[model samples]
Target: MSGRRTTHEDAHDPAPTWTPRLGDLAHDSSADRTGVVVEVPGDGVFSYHLRPERGGADPEWTAPADGSTLSPADD
Candidate 1:
């Protein structure tokens, strides 16, 4: 194989280096998951699986940061 690495799919690729109020997120409590776009990876992938915003807390009940997205609760 070539030295070049295969890139991650772009459709789901998250942008890197969010400038605070910079990242957009999707949450799935049912899936017990959350994610954020970060730049260090440079793969257009989430920096890491987002754990609860705080240790052992329910992030869903938490308020978002200023300018952060707050989708209408569908539950």
Candidate 2:
């Protein structure tokens, strides 16, 4: 077998287990912010588009789809 260790083996904590979907409320732990999933990355896209949940001044931002920092927002 290849000697290279996997990510889970090297990580001090387990990686997150969530994926964002269109219209789903998501939390960006890296940014410490929560927003609505406005758009999900498509064939050529590599990021997720999120908008403020309460129509605030925050501009829509894109988050990586790596599934390590985003999780479903708490209700």
Candidate 3:
């Protein structure tokens, strides 16, 4: 077999880091939930605030804007 890895082999690899922008929909991998990007303070450890896209009474939550814990939500 070849030493190089194939796409299939990479499928199990960790997801690439994703940077979240304002008004962008992102998924919280750690929380296993989806939310909309509502704020980007650009400071502090948790620099992003995400609100539920469905418009719920649930309060907004904070996340890291560095994409280490967030990914673009799949449509």
Candidate 4:
């Protein structure tokens, strides 16, 4: 086998150091939904999930991205 590692081999790597907390507001432009951080799976940053701000169905899991796209929603 080659000395270089493959993408699949990196899957087990640790998650980012930062994670969103519960009640934090997040915005997903692709979904056009601004939701509140409802759960953090403790697996990693990507495991963080959110719920719709207006209240509705269960929140969906989302990938962790730079905070530039997400900010605390106004009260």
TM-score each candidate: 0.21, 0.71, 0.66, 0.46
Better of 3 and 4 by TM-score: 3
Q: Model 2, 1-75: lDDT tens per residue?
A: 988677865667665577788899988988888999987878978889889888778888888867567889999
lDDT of 3 by residue, 1-75 (tens): 878666986878876666688899999888787899888865554578889989879777887656677888999
Q: State the lDDT of candidate 4 residue by residue for 2-70, as single tens digits.
A: 787658757777555444678888765556668888766565654556787878775565645444345
Every candidate's CA RMSD = 11.7, 5.1, 6.4, 8.8
Instruction: Tell me how candidate 4 scores on lDDT.
Output: 0.64
lDDT of 2 at 52: 86
- Better candidate by lDDT, 1 or 4: 4
- Identify the runs in model 3 with alpha carbons over 4 angstroms from their true place: 1-17, 43-46
Best-performing candidate as measured by TM-score? 2
| Top lDDT model | 2
- For 5-74, candidate 1 gives per-residue lDDT tens digits of 5466754655443232224354534444553322222255333333343336544322233213332223
- In TM-score terms, candidate 2 sits at 0.71
lDDT, each prediction: 0.36, 0.83, 0.80, 0.64
The parts of candidate 1 lying over 4 Å away from their true place are 1-25, 33-41, 44-48, 57-75
